[model samples]
Target chain A: MPEITFRQAIHDALVEEMRRDSSVFLIGEDIGTYGGAFGVTAGILDEFGRDRVWETPISEETIVGSAVGAAIVGMKPIAEIMFMDFLTLVLDPLANQAAKVRYMFGGKATVPMVVRMPSGSGTGAAAHHSQSLETILMHIPGLKVVAPSTPYDAKGLLLSAIRDPNPVCFVEHKLLYKTKGEVPNGEYTIPLGVADIKREGTDLTIVTSEIMVHKSLSAAEDVSKEGISVEILDPRTLLPLDVDTITNSVMKTGRLLVVHEAVKTAGWAGEIMASVSESPAWDYLDAPMRRLTGKDVPIPYNRFLERAAVPQEEDIVREIQAIVSNQY
Target chain B: MGSNKINAAYDNEETTDARKKAAELGLTNEDLVSMYEVMVEIRHFEEMATTLYGLGKVHGTMHLSIGQEAVAAGAGFTLQDKDYLINHHRGHGHFIASGADVNKMMAEFLGKETGFCHGRGGSMHIADVTANNLGAQGIVAAQIAMAPGVGIAIKMRKTDQVALVIFGDGAANRGVFLESLNMSSIWDLPVVYLCENNHYGMSAEVGRVSGKVPFKDRAEALGIPGYFIDGNDVLAVYEFMKNAFSHARSGSGPVFVETETYRILGHSKSDRNLYRTKDEINQWKEKDPIIRFRDLLLEADIITVKQVDEIEKKMAKVIEDAVEFAENSPEPNIEDVMEWVYA
Candidate 1:
């Protein structure tokens, strides 16, 4: 195992996949000489040459639509939307075209394409560049949505997404790009519908993903000082949700909490809770299920306001403390 | 002025002159006959489809390309099975032109299991990938954005195959159309952007929407060669498409072509024929591609009037058999609704 930044892990996964499969190519804005907006594709042009690394104009719709077209004809295209907020401009290609092509064509066509969107607010990019829109993608039936929390999961999950027979939306949080974690140096892949229990506990269970996984872990450490044990679970892929893992954890702890960086209303938090309540875990609950998520407001440029918009370590800790104390 | 130039090039009704022009384009007697047969096939398919719609046998609205048979036949006859075609919503003619199986197309329209999309796509989304006929899209400009990617795929595979994308005049105003042309031009991708300018896009006339600018200017601005051809003349469209496909296959980048044609029917089943006058529709009917090409072949003695009648009879039988196949085919199993959502 080698420690690598989440960004390096993603770059490594792309390099490995492109080397292994000739059909795999990267197309997006500034992906060639400019090396992508976040530099995830930095220096990849030198190795793969101009054909595989295409620098496109600022046309999000055509970029994703062309990826769908290329993917249909036996090419694996990984398109970048530059920012998750811009995914609005590409909904027709991503949701209507790429997501539905396989089923619409009676399985005669497959869009093996991955749309990588850099998401979340933390670096003061304001409302336009900062958004946790993975929930929007999850609503589409044919699309697979993945949000990884660590470098290892980022590399492995991305590999699986690239090879998945259908369209996959890979959401990378801007703040998590530089976070370091142990990642295997060789080829590896984590299955899409699996959940990872970041830490084991006995009193309570917390389900979360992306940047919130780190916040939940820190919150668990803080709650432990108050004689409360908390389990943290990250459902890496949101669409094919791992209900069994989530329910099993809830059954053992007899308490559950869902945390995410997305907005509160109509978010994955409520969906996860609904799934758990419908499962066998409903009878095992000793406490009501709770959610800690971003407030319903646009992310502001002010650092304090941005931090207040989403869940922080302290917010997660406070939520755990309140739930344990029967504060509802 | 531009329309007059293009019309004059194909206004020659002389039998010998038409044969000479066809020969100049390397079209033999068999090719001409096959071309005429395909045009007749499209005309019959559309007319029958309209009848089926009237009888409430076909579900969902369908956009008919009744008067645009020559555009479909000329381009469809020019393409190889390995070449790709991206079609728009009003694409039954385009699909038939690209060698799609009539049985499957009719089955899909009738919502049967044996259809190309297992009855999932219905009239607007028929696709025959095995024949390289990428599915027709319901979205107005969706195919335009996706066509350049097919060109990219061909370029990547180092295949000489070119992607011939067909859209309506209305699609030219979309941003993705411009974006695709720019991308294909800069990358030197093998693509032919064909705009079937059938006067009106839905109720909005092309004259009102596109103004005085020719459709070719859309591509010419991007450094791609643009051509305006008389779409009602099958020979003219066939000859121009031949040069365009070759130029694209030569890796000279994409070419844009606008076929000046008309739609004798309304835009869709929902249209009431309220936008244009009946006189306008009748005027377009006089220049019918199928009748014009048949007259040319008959006068040239390239084919007998008896032969032309036989093609109409044979195509009528083909359409009848297709309807029977669809009527007897099973509906998709409801239990398998979850199937094919992914690979």
Candidate 2:
């Protein structure tokens, strides 16, 4: 096992996948020469040459669309949009073309492409660059959305996304890029749509992903003092949600709380709650299921306001504290 | 006015060059008539599709390649199965030219199970992947952006295959089209973006494009060769495409070709026929590609009037048979709605 930064894990996954499959290639703006807007693809161009590590013009639509085209023609293209905000410019290609091509073409063509982008507010990148868009991607029927909180999950999920025969949006929190974790060297992959229970508990079930998973873990520690055992379950892949695991946890704990960095309205938490409510787990609820998400406002540029926009360790602690209170 | 005014005539320098080159190709009367038959097939197919739409047999919206038969026939003739083609809504002609089964295409248009897309996709979504006609997209310039990747794929696989895409002049205005041109040129991808400029994009005229042959501007900026060809002449299209393919095969990079053509009918069935004057439509009909090519063959003694009549009769039967096949095909199974959602 290697203790590597999330950025390094992503780089390793890309390097390993590229080496394993000749059809795999990288395309994006400034991904070559400049490394990347975030340096995730730091030195791939030097290693793979200009053909594979294509440094494209500032054209998001064509970049994604071309990747879709290449993928169908027997090439696996890994396209990067510098920031999550820029992925908006490529929605048509991804939502309309890449997502629908296989179905529209009667499964005759497959778009084996991965679009990677840095997301979430942390470094004061402000409204545009820092936002969680997993909700938007999850809405698309044929797309798979993944947000990994640790270096290990990032490496494994990315490897799986690259090998999967579909379009995958590999979301990376900008703050997690430098966060280090134990990532096994060589080949490894975590199955998509599987949940990882970060810590076992009996009193409450806490479901979260991406950066929020770290916050929820910290909150769990705070609630542990009050004799309230808070279980934290991370559904790494949001689209093919692991309802069985979450439902099983809910049945034991009899309480559930969903947390995410995205805005509260129409967030992915609603879908999780809906799935839980629809399943047999609804009968096990001892307390009302609650969700703590980002406020319904654009993330601000100031460090203090940015912190206020999304949940923090303190906020998560307080929210969980209220959930466990018998009067709540 | 003294130099540039050359109407459609044999003495015109361009047509003369076309005739001379067509002569040098050493094509026999059978070859010429065979090409003529493909054009006839495309024309007949489109005509039948229009009739079926009017009869309420075909569902969803449809766009016909009525007057643009030569472009498809010529490109389809010059292209191979391994080569890729992603076309616009007016792509039924393009697919027919590429040898896509007209019966299945009609079945798809009819929303039948035996259709190219299993009826999940109607006319606008026909994709015969087996023949490598990548597919037809409903979005105007969507395929233009995506088609370049096929070229890179061919280049990566070390194959000489080229990906051909034909879009309307309206699509040329899309930002992705410019991006695609720039990217393909920079990567030297073997793609040819053929802009079918039919004078009008929907109801807007080509004069509104604001630039004189915008493809030239993009081509010059991107350093790719751009050609302006006569879309009504199949021989002219065939000749220019040959050179373009040769350039792509030589790894010279992508090419932009603007085919000056017209749509004989409204853009789609929804068109009220109120946009243009009947006289203008009648004028375009006089220079119809099928009729023009037929006359050329007759004048060159490459095909007899009787032979042309036989092709028309035979094409009518083909259209009739395709209609019957589509009408008789079964509807898709409702239980399989979730199928093909993911590969």
Candidate 3:
């Protein structure tokens, strides 16, 4: 096993897949000479040359449309938008085109492609550059949305996403790029729609993903000192969500707290909350399910305002404290 | 980030040599007659689909490539089995011209289970993977963007196969079309861009949509070899497209072509001929590619009156059989609606 950064793990996955299959290729803006806006593809161009590591024009729609076309014709294309916010330009491609091709074409076509982007708020990137838009993508019926929290998960999920027969929106947290964790050197794939239980607990279950996974785990660790056992679960893939894991966790703990970095209004946490409520876990709830997510406002550039916009470790701890205490 | 209008003008382009190029390209009497036969099949199919739409047999009106059959017949002749094709919603003409099964297409259009897409996708979403006809797209310019990607696959796989996408003039105005041209140019991908400028983008004339810059000239501005041709002349389209395909196949990069054609019918079944005069329709009808090719073949002794009559008669029967196949076919089961959604 090798300890590597989240970015390195993703880079390794791409390199391994491209080497393993010739049909797999990379397309994006500034992904070649500039090595991507975040330098995730720093040396990919040198390794694969311009053929495989294509630096496309500043055309998000075309980039995605081209990937959809390539994917339907047996080529596995991974098209990277610089930031998840820019994915707004790709809605037609994602929602209207890629998501429906397999079904609308009556099983005649399969768009096996990855629309990858850096997501979430941190580093004061302001409103337009920073956004956790997994909820928006998750609403799309045909796409598989993945948000990995650790280097190990990043590598494993990226590999699985590339191999998936359907389109995947691989959302990497911008802040997690440099975060390091243990990753196996050889091949490994963590299947999509499976949740990872980071820290098991008996008193409460905290379901989250991406950067929020770290926040939830830290909150769980802090609350453990007070003899409160908190469970931190990450549903690595969003669309084909692992409801079984979330429900089982809620049934055991009898309390559910869903957290995410997206806006609280229609965020993915609500989907998790709703799913659990509809399942057998609904009767086992000792307390009302609560969500600690980003506020319903555009992310501000001010460090303090940005911090207040999304849930932090302190915010998670405070919310969980309120849930366990059954007091204000 | 900027725009520069090119020096190319559609008005100044050379007129097509329908007869001379037919000889130069070794288009035999059989080849020319075959092109005519495909066009006849398309025309008959469109007329029948229109009747079906009128009878409420086909839901969600279909777009027809009625008078634009030359573009289909010619370009279809240029595509090899391994090459890829992306078509506009009005692509039934190209589908027939490209040698796709008429029975499957009719069944799909009629919403029958035996359709090309198992009836999930109706008239607007037909795709035949075995023929490498990727799929027909309903969106205007969005479909053109796929060619470069398919071209990328061809280039990366070290194959001589080429990819071609046919769109209307209305679609060429979109940013995706220009972006595809620019991307294809920079990468020198093996792709061909074809624009059938049928003079209207769903009633808004092409002039209003694209400010009169010939579609091919816009492609030329992107560093691709651009040509403006008579789309109604199947010989011209065939000659020009053959060059474009071989050019791309030889790794010379993409070629953008604009074929000046007309759609004699309304854009879709819902359209009435309110936007244009009947006289204008009559004039384009006079220049109808089918009649022109038929007359050319007849005069040149390439095809006899009997041969032309035989093709027309055969096309009517083919379409009639297709209609029968669709009429009796079963609809998809409700329980399997979600089947084949995700692999």
Candidate 4:
């Protein structure tokens, strides 16, 4: 395994998939010659040619719609919506169309496409550009939502998302793109609906995903110095949530805290907490499950305000400390 | 016919000329007769659908293409089985003309297990993928946005298959419509954009909703060749589609066609006819495509009055049997509610 950036991992997955299957192609705004807004698709056009790497008009609706269309017609289309916030433009296609087409058509159709949505904040790219919209996509039942927090997870999960016989919404955090980690060079897949426990501990559990996974790990590392062992669980694929790992971790740790960068109100953290509460792991929990997520406000542009809006390592650490102290 | 100014530009005379030269266009009497029969079948099917809706057999409200039979039937004649068709909500006519089985379609409308979608998709979402009818979308302009993908697939597969996307005046105003046209044009993808200008989107008239801009100009602006045709004229529509389909199959990119037809009935089941007067309804009824085509066939000696009567009688029996099959079919099992949600 070679250490590679998350951006390179995603690009490598696309390049490998395209090489393995001619049906696999890339389509989106500036995905061709200009690379992508986040440069995740840089040099892809030169490798694949204009045909495979389609540079589309700035129409997000048709961009996703075309992917659904191509997928049903036996083509693997990986469409990129430059920002997760723009996923709003694609709700009709991704949600009402792609998500529902297979079921609505009585399983006669398969939208085997991947909509690569580069998401989350931390860059100075204000409200319109920096939204963690994975929750919006997760609400749609037929869609498979995956948010990869590391280079290894990004590459493997992307491979699985592209090859999956249904529509998969692959969410990548903008801040994690350049982050480097060990990733296998050729081909591998991390199955959807599986959880990855980054660190093991017995005192408390922090279940998180996307960029927050990295933050939680850092927080757990710092909390270890204070003699509080913490467990970090990342539910990489949010839709088919790995409840067993979450509940089992809670069962061992005896305390649970859900962390995310998305707004606190109706965030995915609530869903995770509710799942744990309903499971047999309920009796094993010695403390009430709590959420350490973003503030209930639109992401601010100011540097300090932005940091304050979402959960940082410090917030996660504080939450872990409070949970261990039996604080509400 | 009375108030519509666009119809004056392209009228039934062009269709009459096409009808006269049907043989010259390599259409035999049998082919012409078959086309006529399809139109009659569509007319009967729509009338039956209307009756079904009235009796509350259809699960949801359906957009009926009652008066616009020729646009669907004529295009159906030109399209091969391999060609793709992306239909709008008002797509029963498009489906039947695309060689859909009436029994399956009726069963779908009735929410029966034997339906094409296994009753998962009712009237608004009927799709026969095996027949290349991609599916009718409930959202306006959704099919327009998706047509280019089918075109891309066709180009990639190196097939001569052309995707015929049928939408309405309402959809033309949508952004995806322009985006799809631009995409298909730039890529030189095989797609034929057929806009059935049935005058109104819902309650708003086409001129009011779309303003003074015609779809032909909009298409031309996007680098696509646009044609304004009389949609009520079956022969004319067939003639235009023959060329449009050929142009698309030849890798010449998409051709935009606006068929100026009228929706004889109200928009949907809930429409109260308050938007327009009965005079307008009766006026479009007189220009009915089925009757017009039948008379043309009769005058040309391509089909006799007795043969026309026979087609009507045959279609009536077909629809009646479809109704019987649908009514008698078993309901979908509750256990399978979540079956098709994935894969």
Q: Who is ahead in lDDT, 1 or 2?
A: 1
**Best-performing candidate as measured by lDDT:** 1
lDDT of 3 by residue, B1-343 (tens): 1122222444322324445657788877677778889999999999999888878888677888889999999999999888898888889988898889999999999888999999988899899866798888877777877777888888888999989899987888787887889989998988899888888888977665566557666777789999988888888788789999989999999998888889888988678878889998999999999988888777777788988888989999999999999999999999998898688
Of candidate 3 chain A, the 10-residue stretch with the lowest lDDT total is: A96-105
- Docking tier of model 3: it is medium
Give the C-alpha miss distance for residue A223 in model 4, angstroms.
1.2
Clashing residue pairs in candidate 1, if any? none
Q: Which clashing pairs does model 2 show?
A: none
The lDDT for every candidate, in the order shown, is 0.89, 0.85, 0.88, 0.88
lDDT of 3 by residue, A1-328 (tens): 6799999999999999999998999999999989999989899899999879889889999899889988888999999999999988988888878988777778888889998999989989999999988888888788999999999999999999999999999999999999999998799999999999999899999999999998888888899999999989999999899999999999999999999999989888889999998999999999999998899999999999999999989989999999999853
| Estimated TM-score for each candidate | 0.97, 0.96, 0.96, 0.98
Report the number of clashing residue pairs per model.
0, 0, 0, 0
Interface RMSD of each: 0.8, 0.9, 1.1, 0.8
DockQ for model 3 equals: 0.76
In candidate 3, what fraction of native interface contacts survive? Answer: 0.70
For candidate 4, what is the DockQ-based docking class?
high
Q: Which portions of model 1 miss their true places by more than 4 Å?
A: B1-16
**lDDT of candidate model 4 versus the reference:** 0.88
User: Taking the tens digit of each residue's C-alpha lDDT, what string does model 2 give over B6-84?
Assistant: 1322211244333455776555556677888999998888888888877877777778788888888878877877788
